[model samples]
Target: MPAQVICIGSVLWDIVGRTPRNMALSNDVPGRILRLPGGVALNIAQALAKYDLSPVALTAIGQDTEGDDLMKASADLGLDMQFVHRPDDLPTDCYMAIEGANGLIAAIADAHSLEAAGDAILAPLTDGRLGSETSPFSGVIALDGNLTLALLQEIAQNPLFSNADLRIAPASPGKAERLRPFLTHSRGTLYVNLEEAGILVDRLFDSSQDAVRALLDAGAARVMVTHGGRDATFGTPDLITSQTPPKVNVTRITGAGDTFMAAHIAAEIQGASPSDALNAALAAAASYVSGDTILS
Candidate 1:
């Protein structure tokens, strides 16, 4: 089947430890450990697949055992992997995070392989397979800030992306500033939390509405700011909308943002209104964090 969306960035394993108790600095607690196929881009792709949208993965994965297993797992989830770069010398990437009843305490991302592979993963875009310079892809593309700043900047200015509906997200708060290049991109829409939005604008925001206005003032063509259990706001220069997520116990927090972005994209593609799309996204994210939806 043809790919309906392009997901670009890290494709890796996630080693997550979850504990029911609230945690603090230097605290150790007994918890369940699980290893799953995850990464910002991969998580979004996996979520898109759940909506029956064929998503093509554009990222680098090593040719080792871990990479092979990851490929099998992604295929099982129905992600198109024909465009994934597999380098023999590099090792598969991984992300580790510790989550408690409170929230995410700490996390580390080892995306060196993806950074080292550089723009090799994007060959399909300019090689006439998906798109070329003369004819650019006009479909939806989801990008993550796990990519190096240089590459992200290039994509922001490249003509190949000028016509695409670009949806981007920061991999984490630490890497949020890497997405500054797209602040003025005409077709780009950013998905970020309150903190991440604040980082991009270099100031603290009190609420999602404030962050939305700040990001738009900072030249974002469109932006969505989520404030955990508070309201989530979506804004463009012409119109701004907000939706409050359903209150639910956050049993997990890792992939909730990705689920929101994917669900929002799918809803918009299905011709939902701005208000309806925001509601759908918030509901999907609430389901994910509440552990009500089964994770693949």
Candidate 2:
């Protein structure tokens, strides 16, 4: 049976501006600019599709023209999006970014709509559509930190996730601290970068291994910390391992982490061991970042 995945978090469009040449402040160079559907949950869901998970998104978007178009784009991709909440007053969220040859230059995210929607997006779970507090949704759930701290705490303590296997990703370093609530959850697996891992562990880490160890010691059952192009560490109850990511020509910087998270979750759902899952995740992320145009 295909693993049932509930992707809970933001769903929005990303506008990225790229430059082939190295850049800095006041440097204006010509490069390709593209727009695509991207958000923590949406990105993971899209990447999970590649692994045949067909995740259903639990998110909210506005009823604006852009929102309609983005929904159409999603439908074209065959994402099972029955859980998305559409509000008339709210405007769909969007993110914009600029990237140079060196790396990411600047980025701005406008996810206020999602933040304002709050637990309303999770109606399915509360209203017995997805699951309830009494009988929570089972199967794998890719949870994001884009949710408010209150909601995160609720999820951590609520019975809704008592039977669910959770794969979590912090939407960004700013909100990474929100996941601290889940440190004690038995079913949680954290996928984070070095800096964000430090936020959760409340200290600085010298290496990926250090971060993973600290997070594991701080009550996380399993932790995977990625140090950019450096070695990625996986720490679990049984073992700790590290794997280097294959070098790839960097075309874009966004969505790479989500790609890794999604692939890892899918691999685990398919019964891959931790080491095998990490390797598969790195390979999928390398392929995703190396080039655009992932041919289905």
Candidate 3:
């Protein structure tokens, strides 16, 4: 399939440990452990693929066993890997997370390889291959904050991105500050959770609506703020819309935000109204967390 969008950031293996009971520090419980292909960009891409949107990955992977396996997995999921950067010297990246009944306990992302690969990962966009500054790729680009802050900053002002519709994700709250540059990009839209929005705005917001306003005030062109089990809001300088996510038992939380972001993007691409898009995204996320098969 041809690429409908480009996903730029970490493409790695996810080692997840999930338990049905609440857990604390040093608490070991019966749980399920699984290894899956995951990353901010990959998660969003996988979800997009579910909507039959082919996304091309533009991240660095290694030439090792893990990288080979990840490539096969991404292919099986229908992601376009032809543009992915694979360096022989760098080892494959990975993320480990433990989720308990209450919520996420901890996560560690080993994305040093991605950061080290640097601008090399973006060569395809600049080398007159997939696209170039003279003829920029004028499609949607899903970017994750796993890339270094310097690269993110460059991308914010780079002419190569001038014509693209950019969708940015902070990857995690710890990396939220890295998205500062994109806040001012005219065509960029940020997908963040309540805490991530607070980190970006330097203030605590009591609700997603408040966070949406704060983010727009902080110079973000557009923002979507989601609060776990609460209302989520999408805001622009001129309009703000809020909707409650459908109530569901959250059996997992790792990739719910990405699912919401992907679903929303898909809905908009298919010409859904803003209200319909938000409802579709919320419904998809609710289904994801409820461990149901997402049909959207």
Candidate 4:
């Protein structure tokens, strides 16, 4: 497959309210607040862009001022922003989160706009620009479970993605089950954490290696399971490999997993072996979690 342009699942801005100190309960703390173009899809696509890969975002942002600003941001990042469906009545989607020194305490994703827009965001892919159902875009496609379950199921069944190299991540641990449809996809590669992998396999795994094995047994074509501050596992149809993440002081953790996924894809696309890919991803994620790398 030609691996030029990749499409990330759903794109939107993230409004993050973060504090330096950790708190146990819902005690409001004052700290730096930031709003950026984020989402599992956008973050992964942005990281891919850093590697000089042109990525198109298949997402819905509303036809509003926020959406306009988001489009400008996407363009500035050198992303292909066409096919971002905007409905007149729907407002642009957003994700709001609170992060402390520990990790992300809570998050609310308002992606109703994308859900309403449905497959309209994929119009370009189905048209001549990218690919259609007949001659599908056989490129690297990064998918996320931020999409509705039904849409994911449809994508799993769609011939347009049947031939593409699929690298997928669940938007969150709670959404991991939504990726079940792609478990059997011939070309799907799953990037998941131990918790998410356990969710998919409907069991508990004491180690990343165990999680990787369980995921492979559950029918994933390829699997990578990350354990924070522990060993991360990578697997092909025949072999499974492991790499330990470099130890670092964890400053933040919101986009760390997404960074790892992007780095993994970029490594493989650059012809790295599974061990090399996992190592690259681990280094990238370690730097990101240590707040050494910018923009995930």
Candidate 5:
């Protein structure tokens, strides 16, 4: 099947340790540790694949055992891996996180391989394989801030992406500022949490609504702000809509935001109304956090 969208950025393994009880510094409790295929782009692509969107991965992976496993896993999940760049010298990247009852305690992302690969990872887009400047890709492009700031800025101004529907995510709160270039790009739509919005706008927002308004005022053409279990809002200069996620016991936290973003994109692509898309995204995220299987 042809690719419906392109997911760009980190593609790696996630090693997560989760404890049902609250934890603090230097405390080690009995918990389950699992390794899963993850990363912002992969997470979003996996979610889209669940909806039969057939997203193509445009990122870097090492030519190692882990990278081979990730490719097989992505293919098994129905993602297109033809565009993934695998360099023999680089080791596969990974993210390690410790999540406790209170929430995420600490995390480390070893995405040096991706950073080193740089624009080489985007060769498919530039070398007339997937797209070119003269005939820019017109499909949706989901981008993550795991990319270096230089690459992100280049994409923001590059002609190759000028005609694409750009959906941007910061990957995490720490990387939110990397999305600054897209704030003024007309084709870009930002997906961020309240904290990320605050980072982008340089101010604290009391709610998602305020964050949406602030982002719009700050030159974001389109924006979506999610506030964990609180209300999430999608907005533009002319219109804004909000929805509260269904209440549920939180069982997992990783990949929830990516799930929401993917669901919203899939909903919009399927011709859902603004309200319907927002509601669907919230419900999907709630289901994911509540430990419901997202894909059949």
Candidate 6:
């Protein structure tokens, strides 16, 4: 089937170590480690697939054995991988994170291969395979901040994305500023946490409501801000909606934001109102963090 959505950015393995006890600096604890197919774009794509949306993942994967395994794993999740750029030079990227009961202690993202691949992965979008300059892709597009600043800037202004419904997210707080270019995109909706929103605006926000309103005032077309287990708000210039996520034990913190974004997108596409969509997203995210949703 043709693609209903396009997920662009890092696509690789996620090695996460989760421990039940709270941890602090220089502390090592016994935990379970799982290597899963992840990355902001891939996570969102996987969630979209579960919603019956055919998503095409556009990113770089090396020709190494890890890349081969990752491709097979992603295909098994119902993602369209035919348009991915597979170069023989770079090795598949990976992200490692240590999550304790308190939260994410530290993480390292080895996405150099994706950064080096750059705009090459987007060739299919402009080469008539999915779309061209004259006939651009008008479907829903999920983008992540794992890309270099230059490429993200180009996409913010590129006509190829002008007609698409863009949903942008930062891969992590460290990469949050990379999404600055799309702050004013007419059709873009940013999914960010309270800290990530503060990074983009350069000011600390007290709550999701404050952050969402501040982002709208700062020229963002639309935005969704989540403040951990507090509350999440979705806002536009004229209207704003808020939803408090159901409280649950957060056993894992890795893909919660991506799940929220994907669930919101799916709800909106199914003609849900903005308020209902926010609720649905928060519910899905709560399930993910509570370890109630199984990852394939």
Clash list (residue pairs), candidate 6: none
lDDT of each: 0.92, 0.85, 0.91, 0.83, 0.91, 0.93
User: What are the per-residue Cα lDDT tens digits for candidate 4 across 161-253?
Assistant: 877888889989988998998786544888888899989978998999999888888888898898899999998779999988888988877
- Error (Å) of candidate 1 at residue 114 is 0.8
| Count of backbone collisions in candidate 1 | 0
lDDT tens per residue, model 3, 162-186 = 8888999999999999999987665
Model 2 residue 162 CA deviation (Å) reads 0.9
Clashing pairs in 5: none
Instruction: At residue 169, give the lDDT of candidate 4.
Output: 91
Off by over 4 Å in 3: 1-3
Better of 4 and 6 by lDDT: 6
Q: lDDT per residue, candidate 6, 176-277, as tens digits?
A: 999988885555999999999999989999899999988888888999999999989999999999888999998999988899999999999999999999
User: What's the C-alpha lDDT at position 228 in model 5?
Assistant: 91
lDDT computed for candidate 1: 0.92
Better of 4 and 5 by lDDT: 5
Q: What is the TM-score of each candidate against the true structure?
A: 0.97, 0.96, 0.97, 0.95, 0.97, 0.97
The weakest ten consecutive residues by lDDT in model 4 span 1-10
The digit string of per-residue lDDT tens for model 2 on 127-174 reads 889898788898888889888898888888778788888888998898
| Candidate 6 worst ten-residue window by lDDT | 287-296
Q: Where does the lowest 10-residue lDDT sum fall in candidate 2?
A: 287-296
Candidate 1 off by > 4 Å = 1-3
Clashing pairs in 2: none
How close is each model in CA RMSD to the real structure?
1.2, 1.6, 1.5, 1.8, 1.3, 1.2
Candidate 5 C-alpha error for residue 62, in Å: 0.8
